[model samples]
Every structure is written in structure tokens, then in C-alpha cells.
Target: MTLEPDLRDDLLAAVPSLRAFAISLSGHVDRADDLVQDTLLRALSNLHRFERGTNLNAWLFTILRNLFHSQYRKRRREVEDPDGSYASRLTVQPEQGARLDFEDFRTALSTLPHDQREALLLIGASGFSYEEAAVICGCAVGTIKSRVNRARSRLSSILKVDATEAIGSDPVIRAALHTAR
Candidate 1:
């Protein structure tokens, strides 16, 4: 029992709407699109179970939401950013408009221990609430906070990137560092 041709067309058309909703809920566009695709497939396969008289849009949204929840549960322990775009913000325009700090920060981040680094990335960089970070990392809120603090300390100490040095790839951090210096 698959969705009819008309229903399939409708599902394809609703991808954008489904994606937007998924992004809002999950805060990651790549995950949102993947969720939408999965929802469409599930809707098509389970079309027979759908009550024809009900709203199809609502049904699809529900399917996508359910899938998102399932993924959250399955990956609670995994540091999975489906979109992989979440990081420190602020536009970077170097002397030649090069994006250098990303590679630098990536190298800096790679050197930290897993726990400390994950905590800082989730809280300081990705803007995840301590509770959300804890849920994502399978830890207590206090533990998450402690990890974040420790991670920042360790990175600052290791990189010697001088939190006070006007040396970020972005204006915001550079300005702050300049002011601090």
C-alpha cells in the first residue's frame, strides 16, 4: 500500500515545508531535509494506514516529528550534527577575504580531550543549553557545565591563541581581542 501518484506528487511538493519545520525543531537544515525525505518515504509506504478523510499535511508533519524523536533517542550518546554546520559565528573577512580561522580552530579543537572539547563545542560554540548538551552527551547538567568551563580553560591554555590577541578570522572576536589587549 503506497501513496497514489497524486499523493506522491503532493509529498514531493511539501518537502520544503516539511524541511522548514524539521529545521525549526532540530536546529539543523541537513537533518531537517533528511527527516523530510524519510517522512515522505514513510508516508508513501504507509499510505494505506492514513485516514483518507484527514489532513495529509498534518499526517506528514507528524511522521517527520516522530522520526526526529526516534533519531534523538537513538543518537543521544553520539556527537551527531547531521548538518555539521553549527560552530562559532560572526562573518570572517581576512586581509584577503580568506577563511583561515576555521582551519586553525579545527586544528586547535582537535587537540583537546574528547569530553572537554565536546562540552565546549556544544555549549560555547553551538549554543546548546547545558540541559540540551547534557541530554545530547548523556550527562548531568552540572557535569556539562563543568566540562564546558574546563574545555575553554584547556583550549585557552593550549592554543595560547591569546584570547586577548586581535587574531580571529572574524571581526567580532578580533575586535573583542583587540579591546581586551
Candidate 2:
């Protein structure tokens, strides 16, 4: 059976209040209109489940609230990447590439002179300042700086990497390259 004439009129009269409630809940006119339309559709479809003597307005409001909450829960897991920048960053580069890059870096580092390697390691890997490295190496701070610079230049040339280019995902390797640049 269809909705009674009086109930239909009641539903028609409830539209303004429903729209206002929807707007207040959603804070967007387009979304509020959609919520009200969905609520009316659900109410009409499920009229048999709605008791006749009870409140109809409350039932519609409950439906609208439940719809909003369901939408919210579903949206919580979604990322709004309209421009695809976030999606672009989600891809993992091949593990083999990183491994090969790391091996190349190690080989280049091993070819550096002993003093230059010590200076680069003390400054880049060990996080020591030039003065601190000089004290440890029993040399002048300028000498330590020169050795690090020479070592970085030699490694970059040996690895065939541009000074500005980043190599691998390893933090230590990245830090060394970044300082070199």
C-alpha cells in the first residue's frame, strides 16, 4: 500500500525543517540537499516499518543523522588526493635499484684515501663538527674540512653522481650526499 494522503502531506510539510536540520549538520548546501533527499526516499520506502501513532519527524532526523555518520566513517579511511601528488609518492622504488646504488656508494667510499675517508666518516657518518674531528685526528680544523670536501668530490666523481642528485633511501647515504651538495 502507498502512504496515506495525510501522511504524504505531513512529509511534504517536514521538508523545510529537514533541509534546515541537514544544512546545520552538514555545513554544505549540496550535501544537505542530498541528505534530505535520501532521508525522504528512505522514509517512503520503509513506511511499513514506521509506526503510525509515533513521531515521523524524529524518524527522518534519525535517518539523516545515521546517514551522515555512516558517510563520515567511510570517508575517514579515504585520502582526498585531487591532484594525485600524494598518490605519486605512494609508489615504492625497486629494492634492487636501492641495493645496487648502495653497493656502488660503498665501492666509491672504499677507494678514497685513508685520511680523506676518516675525515668524511667523522663528519658525515659520525656527525662530528670540523673542530671536533680535527681534535680527534690531531689536525687543524681547516685540514679536516679540506679532507672532507676532497673525499666527497672524489666519491661523487667515482660514483658518477651529480653533486645535487640524491642516491638512495638510506639515511646515512642521503645525509652524506646532501652535505656534499
Candidate 3:
């Protein structure tokens, strides 16, 4: 059975959760949106597979989650967080806000080496586990973890990130920096 007009509307309402789950799986916002759209389309096509009386939201989530897993298993390396900070560390250190220049931060990120960029994006920007990142990168998990750390060190140096001044001027960094402080 195809998703009827009413079912389609119900499907649409779950898009937000789908997108969020997609991002958690894929790391890139655009990619997440794309995944969500793909999931909806897939659901529409396979609506007959959905068991009536089962949870519609759960069914949709299963579709999206399964799709993500399929993509991940096929090629984990497809959308790895290239920057090492794992999305978790991208926050700016609060107290250092006064010293930040958005331009400088952007420029500095651009100046980072490719490997460094990859490391930061995967670990810092995406928030992937090292094991997951490594699987995605087709490398040892340790290598993935190391790349993240090394990239952080490189950024700290390039940005002249003072332990005292805060490692990042961004709130993410600020929260991390608070512990450091």
C-alpha cells in the first residue's frame, strides 16, 4: 500500500526527528536532510511493508535507521568527520569570546592540513566515536583517535590557543575550556 495522503501527512510530521537521527548518523546537516528525504521516499514506496496497528513513527524511524546502517556498512568512510574535534570540541571557550575574530578562526581552519582537517571534522565536528570514525576512514581506530588529538594540538598551536585564554573562543570550546580552566 502506498502512503495515502493522510499517511503522507503523518510521515511529514516525523521529518524533524528523521533529520536529527540522520545527522547523528551522517554528521553533515545536508547529508542528514538528504537521508531523511530518501527515507520518506523509501517509506512511501514500501508502505505495504508497514504493518498496520504498529507504531508509524517507529516504522519510519526503522526505515531511516536501516537506511543509514546500510549506507554505513557499505562504505563507512563516505561522510566521516574530517576535522578531528569530533563536533564535541568545536565549541568556543566562553571567556575567550572577547578575543575571538570569526575571520581569524575561519582563516585558521582553512590553513589546517588536509589530514588535520579530516581528523577534526570526523572527531570534533561530527562527534563520531573513534572506532566509528576509523571504520569510516578505513583505518585503525587508534589512528582515528590520534588524528583527532593531533589535529586539536595543531589547532591549539595555530590559533595560539592559550590554556589560560581558552582553547576555543566558541561556546563548545568554552564549555570544554571551563573544565580546562
Candidate 4:
């Protein structure tokens, strides 16, 4: 059932904080906004199921969190363009150098063990605190830190990443390298 007018208005008012939380979770503003929109739509559709007098903020967050995890899982099975052959064909000449670095970074990222990769992405890319990531990953904070550390070490080893070098200029690689150091 659709949300009543009053409930919809309340949801609209919560957009800003919801967007901020989404950005924190997703890192990219674009992806976070998309998640917020999806969350709003889901909340509206499921309004009938929402219990009255409950915490709307918590409800919306739960919806967004569930959506992010679902999308994350879906992306895990999708093939990535490691060589940038597909992306390269669509980019202009000037941007191709950056694109190549991105491809190498992607290749190096894929080499890490899945747990480490998850920890790294959660803290480095997604901006989650170690404790928050541990909560999400169902592990202790120390475990999350250890996983991220191992992931960073493995990535540095695999890519021979130098903090002062050209590869470090790439933001994605730089974030990992920066945090590792």
C-alpha cells in the first residue's frame, strides 16, 4: 500500500539526514543519493507494515542498510572490467592514462582475499569506522582493523605501490595506500 500523505511528508523531511547517512555508507554521493531514493520508495511502499510510534529514523536506516547489502552482494557476482578494454573504448584519449591506472588498481584489488578486501573497502572506500565496520561484518573491532591491515599490506605488495609515485595519484589507490601507511 502507498504511504499516507502525512507519512510521506515525514519521509520527505528526513531526506537530508538520510542522504548524509547514505553517503557515509556508500562513499559516493551519487550512489548514496540513489540509495536514499530507493529507501524512500521502499519505505513508502511498505508504510502499511510500519508500526506506529516506532523510530522512523531507525526504520529508514534499516531499509537503506538492507538495500546496500543486497546491492553489494549482487555486485560480487558481476564481472569487472579489469583491463579497462571496455571502459577504454568509451573514454577520450586524455583520460585513458588515469583509466589505465584504475584498471591496474582494480586488478590489484581483486587479488586480495575477500575478507580483507571487504574490511579495506568498508573503512577506506565507504568511510566506515572500524567499530562500525566490525558491527556490519559481525566481527570484533580488532579483527576489522587486522583485516584492513592485511588487505593493505597485500595490495601494496601486489601493486608495489609507492606513496609518492604515479599510482598514488589515483584517488582509489591513494586512499588504500594512504590508510595503509
Which of the numbered candidates is closest to the native, going by highest TM-score?
Answer: 2
How do all models score by TM-score? 0.41, 0.50, 0.40, 0.45
Minimal lDDT window, size 10, model 1: 172-181
Model 2: lDDT to the true structure: 0.86
Q: Tens-digit lDDT track for model 2 on 1-181?
A: 5767999999999999999999998899998999899999988888889998899999988998998888778888999999999998897768997798888888888889999999988998889989999999999999998999898888878877775355877766665655533
Clashing pairs in 4: none
Model 1 local distance difference test score: 0.73
**Clash number by candidate, in order:** 0, 0, 37, 0
- C-alpha positional error of residue 130 in candidate 2 after TM-score superposition, expressed in Å: 1.1
lDDT tens readout by residue for model 4, 14-48: 99999999999889999999999999889877877
> lDDT for every model?
0.73, 0.86, 0.71, 0.83
RMSD to truth, every model: 17.0, 7.5, 18.9, 19.1
Winner by lDDT between candidate 4 and candidate 1: 4
| Better TM-score candidate (1, 4) | 4
Give the TM-score comparing model 2 with the true structure, all chains together: 0.50
lDDT (tens digit, per residue) of candidate 3 on 1-181: 5547877788878988889889998999987988898898898888788887789999988888998888878776655577766766666546544446445566676777776567667666676767888888888977776666666666667767666254434544432222121
- For model 1, residues 17-127, the per-residue Cα lDDT tens digits are 898999998998888888888898888778889988788899999999899999999889676455665534435455543256545556777887899788777776676
Off by over 4 Å in 4: 1-94
Which prediction has more favorable TM-score, 2 or 4? 2
Error of 2 at 13 (Å): 32
- Decide which is better by TM-score, 2 or 3: 2
